[model samples]
Structures are given as structure tokens and as C-alpha cells.
Target chain A: MDLILTPNITDPDGFYARLIAAHDGLSDEESAALNARLILVLANQIGNAAVLEQALALAQVGK
Target chain B: MLNDRYSLAFKLYPYERSSDQDAAQPVRHPVVIVGGGPIGIATALDLGQQGIPVLVLDDHEGIGMGSRAICFAKRTLEIADRYGCGRPMVEKGVVWNLGKVFHEDRQIYDFNLLPEAGHKYPAFINLQQPYFERFMVERVRELQATGTPIEIRGKNRLDAIEVRDDHVVLDIMTPEGPYRIEADWLIGCDGASSPLRGMMGLDFEGRVFQDSFLIADIRMHNDDFPTERWFWFEPTHGAGASTLLHKQPDDVWRVDFQIGWNVDRKEEMKEENIRRRLDAFLGEGLGYDIVWSSIYTFQCRRMKRFRHGRVLFAGDSAHQVSPFGARGANSGMQDVDNLGWKLGLVLKEQAPESLMDSYDTERCFAADENILNSSRSTDFITPKSKISHTFRNAVLQLAEKHAFARPLVNSGRLSLPCVYDNGPLNGEDALPEAPARTRPGAPCPDAPLADGFVLDRLGGDFVLLTIDADAPEQLDVGGIALRRVKLSVNDDATGALAERYLGGATSAVLLIRPDQHVAARWAAFDESAVRRAVGHACGKE
Candidate 1:
């Protein structure tokens, strides 16, 4: 399956606000955990281990 | 020992005032509810309020003995609000949304469930289940007083169920003797360890939790602890296991201690052992009096199917989850919310019987979601495997220093409403660029309407939310109620409704089902479009 590479999110600001809202009032460590859980949730939705590995590699390249 | 709440033996009042079962006269009704708990009575109230005749059978007489299942979520309160039984619960219940999580006596993080509120109800109410059940029971009684044709037959235990082609025959054991009654539809709200489930030869299958926990509600006159949920993982006081504390109404504080699995269950429940443990766990001297105490083992299990020919199951009979997330009774209430209206419409011949299939499909999906979250929470708290324990500890360690790791620390992901995405009952999403929230197959997000909340406008009918446009004068609902209201830009003072539902569309029409789930949306109204959407929502298409 191909990855979603296009700019798909219509309202980026709104989406970001919701993402921040989900982690609002959480401490920095808690925020990190929330991000980890979010990544895990997305990875599970992705389901393909190869795609997950490739995505992890891509995410690591920028960092 | 029975707690103070159950010591008086609540007046049962002989609900079945008269019975023809001993005479072997099989009385028929539209619906037969087989449990008298909160879930059962809530379903009966919802159905009875809609003019659907129902007969409820319960083995016990009055409210449950102890304060079990105290936390009621906002979505459940909304469902109860629809039936006029939720207000008293909210008034008397302790409302709280902030939850504080700690790791070994160090404060880690806190969460606000509802950051901003445009909705009618708060995020949750820490009310005892018996009080909520009593409210629903009184609502049913009020409906009965109004001649809505409902029978609450206490002590009429369901001994046997004979599921025929189109109806159900129930053998109920009454105070005098054995008798039978037939019903067009049978609902088993009979809780976990449901006799009805066993009678039907069905199995509750899933992971069996090994660890045991002691839950106690104690009455103390301390005002130091605020109204919030406090959770500790491996506290010095708790001796390595997790603990949860909450302040309930009537100066009662609910405390949970994760005692190990190998301990003697009965001996652990003894007052002496309980007092000894509480002294160690709470750190407060012997001032507080224990109001109720019970031991429980967690399990994340559910029935394979919610519907069986003419017999159906709701609440614990259909699904059972650990008590961490407050999902048990809340999900049970949502079960009735999904089934009640469809059953009412089907009985009235307004909607096809096939609509009930959507209940099975959507609710089973929700049950799976609840099971998954609950299972994950139990694993995080207990961590059976070595690697799992290492990962959990690392997350907790990292959570103290970084914000991202904080979300990984799950004390118990408090209950949230399920969004039924892409279900069979959802009408087509014909309008492109529509908002994500009010998309087809999702519960309509609560918004501020004039003088009330959005859910306050929805119930007992298909509501068409027309924005900046006049409601169509002519549309057929096929004997089912259809409500059409026009909300102008001025009507939504806060603009939360417009931002969620109408994203720059001058005139958008949304078709919502009776359960307040979005069935379809169109940029413009068309008679045939509405007819088709209604057909699909009613499961006729």
C-alpha cells in the first residue's frame, strides 16, 4: 500500500488545536507519552510492519 | 456484611401487583426486560416513555445493596437527560473532570476531560449506581402512573427462555410459583453472570484477569481532598501495586487497593484484614467508617453476538469490561440508547425490523473498542510480562521529564462516547468538504442551541438541522416523527454549532436519527434525498 504523502489535512490549524487539546494540561513527560500513544495508534492503523519501519525511518531522518 | 446503604432492605413494593403466570396465562407484551438493574430500568424507561408497552422482570426487589459502578460518563448523562431522569442524578452527584496521575508518590500529570463546555452535561458524575438506578426506576414508575403501560415485576425471575421464530416465551419464577409469559421482543439486561446468557447456552469469552483488587467506600469528614480522581502507581503506602481514590458525595471517599492474586479472597475481605490494609494504604487513622467493601477480579469479555433471533442482550450480558474506565454501566446505557428507539419504531411498524441489526453491528464494534481500551489499561496498570513491565516503567520514568511520555501513562482512560464511523445505518455523505465531526455515522456533537443544548432538541424523531434556510414544508416520514428546525447564524450565539456542522455552507441540511447520530448530510435539501436517507437509516434500503 502507498503512503499518504499529499497534504491531506484540510484545516491544519484546527487539527493541531485538537491534537494540542488532547494533551492539554499534561506535563511534558505526559505529553511525550501522549505522542508515543498517538504514534502507536497510527502505526496500528497502518498495520503493515514494512510501512511502519519505513515511516519510522523517514521520521528519524528529519530528527 | 451488608453495607449501610443496603441494611434497611429497600421497599420493593410488589411491582407485579397482579400476576397471571400462576394461571398459566401467557400475557404478551411488546418488550420484556429481564433485569432490573440500572441498564434494564433505563431501557424500560426509554421504551415506556415512547409509549412502548414493556414488562420488566427482576430477581431482586429494590436498589442494589452497595455502591457499585459509581462513575457515570457525560454521554450516559445525555441519554438519561433525553428521558427526563438525568437531572436529579446530576444535581445529587459529584461532578469532576480533572484526573491526577502519580507515580510512586510523585505527581506526574493531570487531564481535563472537557476543556471547554458547550454541552449540557459535565464530563462525568461520581454518583453511585444505585442512586442512578433508583432515578430510572422512579422514571419508569412515573410513566406507569401516566398510564404508559409498563409492568415492573420484582421477584419475577426469568427461569427459562424459549426463542421461537418471531417471539420469545419466558418462564418466570414468581413469589407464589412458576409461570410463563410471551413477548414480541426479549431483552436480557441481566448483568454479568447473567442467568439468561447461561440459559441460552451462550458463553462470555475473553481474557480472564488474574489479579484481585479491593474496593471500599468510606465515610469521612475530611475536606482536604478536592473533587477529582487520584491514581497512584506503586505508592509507598500501597506497597508496590496501583491505587485509585475519588471523593464521592455524602463525605464518602472511594478507595481501591490492588491486592495480589495469591491471597485468600474471603480472608482478605474480613473486616480485620480490611481495616489493617486501609490503615496502611490510606495513612489516615481509624477515623473514617467503612460504608461498603467488595473484592473484584478484572475481565475483558463479551458475547459473540448481541442479538439471537428474537432474544437480545444488553449491558453486562452482552459485554463485560474491567471497572477502571467506567465503561460497564455507561456502555450498557448506550446499548439501550441504540436499541430502545429502534425497537420502539419497529414495534410501531414505523421502521423495519432490520434496523435492530444495526444495533448489533454498531454496539459490537463499540464493545470491541471498550474491550481494547480496558485491556490495554489493565495491562499498563498490572503488566504481567517482563517486557511489558519494563516498557511501562520506562514510560512512567520518561513521563516525569517529558510531556509526550505523559499520554503513555494511562491510569484509566476515562470513558468517552464512541463515534460510529461508516456504519450501515449512516446515511450517505453526499456533501464534500463537510465538517469531520458531523460526518455521517457519528453521534451529533452536542452544541449550544437557543436556551438549551443540541441533544435537548433531538429525541423521539428524525431531526433535520437546516442552517440559514427555511425548513421544507412537505416531507414524508412514513409514520415516524420528523422534526425540522432552522438555525440562523444569530441563533448560534457561540458559533460552536456552526463551526462543527456548517463549515461555510450557506444552507446545509443534516438528517439525524432518533439516537442523535448523523444519518446523512446534503448541501441542499431534496425530497427524494431525504426519503432515501430515511430509508437507509431505518434499514429498509
Candidate 2:
């Protein structure tokens, strides 16, 4: 499943980068799974639409 | 009457004359601690607890004055518990749950340190340091009464120390006369202006911030302020800085003001000026009376090395940081915790003296990180220049309005404990792919056990926890003993912890040492593998 995740408002890339970095030694499937789990946790923490928009913008920039 | 009380209080005579010293000479203890402060008393307590004889020589007749180090972190409480002192400490201390930051009259940020679900103690407790020291001294006396023979030569001063290959000899000056003492190890726990550190010719290198702070213990009636830490940011007073208000025991409040460098030190500390600042921040016409006040300069400095041959340094003698996040004394007590068990092992012949090198390595790492964070906070509070001030204020402003910025700003970088990843005891597997855990190099996270006791309950010594539900494997390492306990994976709390820490995976076993560092861990419940990992870390074949 292709999943699109948004970041938190302050440093969306920072958390995403940390998640990716923690899983850097894992297999491609493992990294993707971990990233998906982190996205859910971050989404639960920053539940605001404005923050979600900024996070989405940050993710796009990283891409 | 006094002699009758003294005789009744003791099981045996304390001051027995040794044959080695007759009328010609007096008996000298093996180790003589120079200062009677918390650090000195703690060192003596640790050594005495291990059956080693020590005489603490203090210039004061009683425990030192002042309520210094009123804040104790969870990690420190773990250490105190190991020394059989944590119960009283917890009973007397005031645990804080929330902290608020205000700018002018508006609430800028409010953070809650919700007790971690599995941890026994809260994040921090505020207690008077003098009471804590007295408790330690009384514990020492109790040990002495039981023939443990921990001596404290009050009104005694250290004149000189000469280090030899075998022992460190101390020349002490007492009220009666001069004496000499020889010790296997000499520890300097004296404050930042440590004479021992200076005598050893070691350099304490770091930036000394020009800003000075005023700490006042006062009695005030503020019903609005809950039993939480309140920080007033950018006050109109001397250079837009911060003010701290912390609740103490017995209706007393400890307040700290970050007075800028512009104010003269002499004029800033005047009683009238201090009262004025207290009134301004606490609101007008609040019936408040000042108890005691003092001015101090904040400096972030650490010795180039913690150990120089036989002499070791702990507490403020080893490192100094600004009192922004209460890292200074907490980290020093942690230094004692790290060194105590290792020194005990060496003295007991369980481990070689070479193990002492890890104390320097581990504590230096902690000190370095503390200096970095405290320096950052110091810079944040007292910006060196206009550009720096503008930048800091801009970041804080951004943090105020943005949720993302809030966590980033309050990363609480100062409070985070740094593990020794590259220390002697930390092996090749120390560099784990997973995030941090309660491991050898890292401080143990507070975990709640099924019995209602927290993970910190197991911290006084080495603990072996089995996460596997079936057929828990048990194997012994060479010299390091392991106490095995079954962690029921079926419990709801265990399931949550497995999800949070192990990424929803199981079958891992963890071994933690008394200092709350993860000594070893096995991905799968393999007895032989766990034994080998423990053996390697403990320097046993």
C-alpha cells in the first residue's frame, strides 16, 4: 500500500529523518513499516489541520 | 550523664587505641575525606557501606548550611535507594508534576511530566539538601554504632596530600593537633573551587558566563501558583531575563532571578534590591518575607579528566553547570553512583582495579553533555550580543505559537542523560540499531513491574529480566551474578511496553547493572548468548 504521511509543523523533516535514520540499517520492507508506524504516532500527537498542512509541505520538500 | 548516654548508645567502644599507635603516636585511618559536604559524606558512605574504613575530616562541626541541590532527578533517587537512603528522601521530598512558563501575564507554555507508566518515582523531586546530608550522616553514625567504624573528625582540615604508588598520604590539621592518614584511594568532592583539583594541576576548561543570578528563599502567599514550577520570561527588570519560582517544604518558596551583567554585583545583591525583585514578579502587596538570599555566577566548566592516577574527582569538583535545569548536583550524585559499585568490586577483589578507568570515561561523557546543554540554556537566557538575543527570542516566539516548536524548544536537552557508548565496559554490540533503552551505556528507563514496583526498584544492583513467556533460560556469567525475574508477556502493561520499546516484537532479555545502565541484552532468549554478553561486559572470561 502506497501511504502518504504528513509531518509535524515545527520540524516535520526532523522526525521523518530520525525515523529513516533509525531504520537505516534495516531492510527496505522493515524501514517502510517502521516509517508507517512513526507516521501514525506523529499524526496522533499533532492533530491540527494547520500543522498537518505544514507537515505535508515539509514532506513534499523532502521528496 | 553524657558518658552514660554515649555508653548506652554504643554496642562497643568507638575510640579504641590501636597497638600500632601508643602514647608516642595516634592511630590514622586508611582513607580521610577532606570535606564533610554531601559529596564527601556520600563518598565515605559508599566506601563504608562496602566494609572499607574511612575517616571524614571536616572543618565544620555539623553538616554544611544552605539548601543547595534542592532538586533530585529519578536517576539520583535510584542511587540513594541503593545506599539505603532513598526511602527517607522520597518521604521528605516534594514531587512536582507540572511546570509553567509565562511572558508578562500570558502563559507561554505549560508542560506536564506525567509519571512514565512503568517508573516507580516521578521525573523530579525538590528536597532540602541539608536534610538529605543529615540523613546520610545519621546513616553513617548508625553504621558506626554497629561496629562498622566510619569515623568523622569534625573541625579537622586538610593541610597537604602526597600520592604514592601504594597509597595517598594526607597531612591533616585538627583542633587538638596535626595528624597523618594514608588511603588506598583519595576522592575530591569539594565544590567547584576544589583545592584538590587545583593541587593536582588539572585545568577546568569552559566559558564562564558574565551574567550573575540571585537565589532567594522566601515565604510568600501566592494562591494562584499551584504546586508546580513557574518561570516568568523576559521580565521588565534587569535585562529581559527569566525568573524561577519553586515550592519548597513548610510553606517556603525558592525563587531565582536571572539578573543581567549590566547591574553591578554589589548593588544587585543588596537586601532592598532582592525584596523589590520579589515583589515585582510575585505581584504588589503580597505579604512575603525573605528568609535568606545569595548571589552566584553561573559557569559551565569540567576538568580535562576526572581521574589522575589514584585520585578521582566527583561532583562539582569534576564538573560545573549553571542551575538552569538542576543538572549540577544530580549529575554529581550520579557520578558517585557510577564509581561506588565499581570501587566496591575492585576492593572486594571481584574485579581488577583497571575497572576504575570506566568511572572517568562514563562520568566525563555525562559532564560533557551537561556542559553542552547548560551552555545552550545559559546562552538562551543571557544572549552575548544583540544578534544572539534576537535569534533566541525569535525561536522562542516561534515555539510559543507552533506545536512542533514547543517540543523542539522543550526537548529538555539539559535533563536527558547521556550514555557512554564508547566506554571500556561498552562492547561492540553496544551500538544497537534500535533506539535508546535501559542498557549498559544508557541510563535505564523507568519501567513498571507487575507487582506495582517500578523498574527503578531493581536498580540498586545487577538485575536480569526475562521477557520470554515460556521456559525462561538461566545461565551464569563468570564473575557477574544475575538475578533472574520473569516478565509476564501476557500482562497488558508488558504488551504496551513491548510495543513502545521493542517495536511490537518479543523474546528479548535485558540485564541491567546497579547504576541503571543496560549491561547486556539478547534479541532471543538464548542462555549461552546472554551469559557470554554479560561475561564480556563484566571483564570475566
Which docking category, incorrect, acceptable, medium or high, applies to candidate 1?
A: incorrect
Per-model RMSD to reference: 7.6, 9.2
Backbone clashes, candidate 2: 5
Per model, kept true contacts as a fraction are 0.00, 0.04
**All models: lDDT?**
0.80, 0.67
Q: Judged by lDDT against the true structure, how good is candidate 2?
A: 0.67
Candidate 2 TM-score versus the reference: 0.81
lDDT of 1 by residue, B256-324 (tens): 989878878888888888887778766756478889999888789999999988888999999999887
Model 1 score (lDDT) = 0.80
Tens-place lDDT digits, model 2, residues B66-152: 566788887777667666687788888888888886664567778787766655666678887877777777778787888775777
Candidate 1 per-residue lDDT over residues A3-30, each given as its tens digit: 5544455643335335545664666678
Q: B179 in model 2: Cα distance from truth in Å?
A: 0.4
